[model samples]
Target: MLDERAAGVFTIAATPFLPDGALDLESVDTMVDFYVERGATGLTILGIMGEAGKLSSEESVAVIARVTARSDVPVIVGVSAPGLAAIRALSLAAMEKGAAGVMVAPPGNLRTDDQIASYFQNVADVLGDVPWVLQDFPLVTGVQITPKVLRRIFDACPTCKMLKHEDWPGLEKISALREQEAAGARKISILCGNGGQFLLEEVRRGADGAMTGFAYPEMMRDITALAHSDPDRARDIFDAYLPLIRYESQPGYGLAVRKYILAKRGAIAHPTARKPGPALSEAAIAEIETLIARQEARLSAL
Candidate 1:
């Protein structure tokens, strides 16, 4: 099971869909192998990148079962829902299907710190013994979780073992959380996830590792590996990829770009975002290709 000791790249695996928008289970197998071979220490399926909200509950369970079965590394399933019953139901299915743990993001309606803290306490009560990740992506969730509120939740929920720290300008949160842990607060793992834009700074600020789908899992792997021992080289590699990273970080269109690159890398067969999700324009595709070429050239030069 996932614990506070969990570290390293847990690539947020994309849900593969055929041109007709069917789940490409074959690609799920290949994508699992691709991420693991590329040095992913774990795989996080059914995440924002995985199009979790778009999938049916049955489809979600299928993904959980398939990924957990194929992954040599541990698998974390995102089970965020509008209600605790849905969260508990999905989390239970994920655990029973062999997932290492589940991830939960707060609903956007949470306003007060007490409300936020109380919601997760209820989540913990429903989850019981299932180790879970608290996904703190304020940019998407519109729910800001302060470090103090986090401390309260952690103190209350023993099974919440990891934090998917994706808050923008959140490096200070990482530092603050570590300081709190130093002062005897619960010490859960902190894995950052703003498409890895702040991964280097995050690790430097006491993040355990990255939990984002940056398309290039190897970059996260290498940077985390070399962060403490060889900061200069790490920065060099990070700089080489920063352009493509920034390009892929665009809101609304990022996942389309990510799926395109993943398909190009042979991790998946098609780049189809499901209906209602954005698709890349021809000009956007050209831009991403140019960025990838330049990024590769820079890395080679380095």
Candidate 2:
């Protein structure tokens, strides 16, 4: 069992892209500094928020290499794809590039528990000693890793140290993992990954911390502090930030909102994402602006 204290808020970062849709290494560096400075304990690059599915294997490796070179803080590269070979290759590439761990999802649209376990075990076998975080995102991957399957994989791969529990039933999953730990069973860290909407609840339910897509680390930092110091106060802060979370969690506008906010704060050059993923509609953009305005107004009053 890994120490819970070692696990903290991990950011599933956005992969800043140039206007031409190429990887923006400079912006990646800036974002890394942005998160590290504001209290992110580690970074999980090329995850869903980073648009890993849109990036080629080589492009993903380049981005991971850039992030790994800039910081000693733990970097968990996302190795989510269809084939076992492709997943293994990506995981090994991340490990070779010096990432502390790799985050992976089961094969898309295939929800069989056995297949999911095999997917993780195969990648773990190829990874050897490298650690991994099973990304439990049922929305995108269409595969739910049940608690029984989770235990099987953890038993198979001792190096699978954590789980980015994005499943909506996240609190229930956390409870199960904790029960296992209490029974002297294989222990694993559970991170809140469904943005900040469920963060307070997850932490109260025993999550180590969060791995959300929101770019404003300050908001997450403040909530984390509140959760640690005063739970009721944390809920109050969460209530205040609920509007911003709603704006960012909007369908088709989530990443757009993240990039726009990052750009608004000058954390990135522009709020641009790759093609096929449309830009935020005018109304969506306006909603984000309104959310930011509300946040700023509250800050000024404070």
Candidate 3:
């Protein structure tokens, strides 16, 4: 289970697909192996980046069962749904298949602090014994959870074990949450998750680690490890990869870039995203190649 001491990079895995848009289950093993070799301490599947919403309930369980069976490290499945019943059902199904924990994001309609806190209370009540991660990604969820509200949730729900913090421009929120804990509020794991863009700063502000998926998770591992030891060295490594990080962080286009890079590296056989997501343009592909080239040279220098 995730806890206050949970640290190191937990790679958010992608759901690989064949050229015909079928699930490439073979790539599931290859990609899990790739993350472990590259530096993932744990794996989070069916996250936003993993195209979780696109999968059916049966497909979701199949993916979780396959990944947990193959992975030696703990796996956290994104089980957020539009209702408590669905969330409860999915969480039980996921844990029955050996997931260490499940993640839940607030629904889009939640507006006030009470709504957010109460939503999690319902989650905790429904989940009962299952541990969960509160995904505080306002940009996607449109439900802003203030630090004070977070403390209330902690006070109310003992089962909310972690926070997938993605409130952009909220490095101070990380500091605020840690400060709240220091002031005797319940302390829980805080893993920053904005695709590793603010990883260095987030760690410095007191995030436990990253629960983000960048094409190269080794950078997150190396950066977080060095940041804990030598701040200067971490900044040096972070800057080297900043250009590519920015490029790969595009909202709609980012996943395509990641899939292409993974396929090029032979971690997967195909780079196709599911239906309704556009393919990468020739020009965009060219730009990514340039960024990859520059990233390589900078890494070698470092």
Candidate 4:
């Protein structure tokens, strides 16, 4: 099970799909191997990046079973749902499939600190003893979870073991949580998201590591390893990938870019996003190619 001590890269995995919009189970195995081989100490599946919302309940469980079966590293399954029953159902299924833990995000309707704390308390109750991650991505969820509220949930629920810190300008939240821990509050792992745009700074602000998806998990793998022991070198490597990272951070179409690079790198067979997703234009593809070429040149020089 996941604990507060968890650290290092927990790559948010992409759900592979066939061109026909069907689940590609074989790609699940390959993606797992790719992440693990690239030095991801852990893997987070069915996240927003994983296209979890596009999958049916059965498909979610199937994906969970497949990944848990294939991954030797800890697998954190995103089980966020609108209701406690649904969350419980998926959390139970995930735990049964050998997942190391589950992740839950607040539903958008939450409007108060009490509501937020109560909702997570209810989530912890439903989840029983199964460890879970508190996802704090306000940009997508429209719910801003203050550090005070997070501490309330942590104090109320011993099973809530991690925070998926994705809030923009959330470095202080990390520092505040660490300060709280210093003052003797519950300590939990704080892995950052947001496509790793601020990974270097987040680590400096006391994050455990990255919990976001990118085409090249190795960049995160290497940077996190170098962040402390060789801070300047980490910055150089992070700078080399900044252009591609910035391009892939494009809202509403970032996943397509990431999937494109993943396919190009042979992690998946195709870059198809499901229905209602935008496909890359020829111009966009050319731009990505240029960014990747430049990134490679910079990395080689480094």
Question: Please, what is the whole-model Cα lDDT of each candidate in the order they appear?
Answer: 0.93, 0.80, 0.90, 0.93
Off by over 4 Å in 3: none
Evaluate candidate 3 by giving its C-alpha RMSD to the native, one decimal: 0.9
**Better-scoring candidate (lDDT), 1 or 3:** 1
Question: lDDT for model 3, on a 0 to 1 scale?
Answer: 0.90
Model 2 lDDT tens row, 19-49: 8988889998888888888888888888878
> What TM-score does model 2 achieve against the real structure?
0.93
Superposed on all Cα atoms, model 4 deviates from the true structure by an RMSD in Å of: 0.7
lDDT of 3 by residue, 145-253 (tens): 9999998998898888889899998899999999998988888998888889999999988898899989898999988888879999899899989999999999988
How high is each candidate's TM-score?
Answer: 0.99, 0.93, 0.98, 0.99
C-alpha RMSD of candidate 2: 2.1
Candidate no. 1 TM-score: 0.99
Runs with alpha carbons beyond 4 Å of true place in candidate 4:
none
| Clashes per candidate, residues 3 or more apart or on different chains | 0, 0, 0, 0
User: Model 4, range 1-302, lDDT digits (tens) per residue?
Assistant: 89999999999999999999999999899989998999899999999989999999999999999999999999999999888899999989999999999999999999999999999999989888999999999999999999999999999999999999999989899999999999999889999999999999899888999999998999998888889889999999999999999999999899999999998988888898988798999999999999999999999998
- Across 189-231, the per-residue lDDT of candidate 1 in tens digits comes to 9998988899999999999999999999999999998889899
When 2 and 4 are scored with lDDT, the better candidate is 4
Q: How well does candidate 2 score on lDDT at residue 212? A: 82
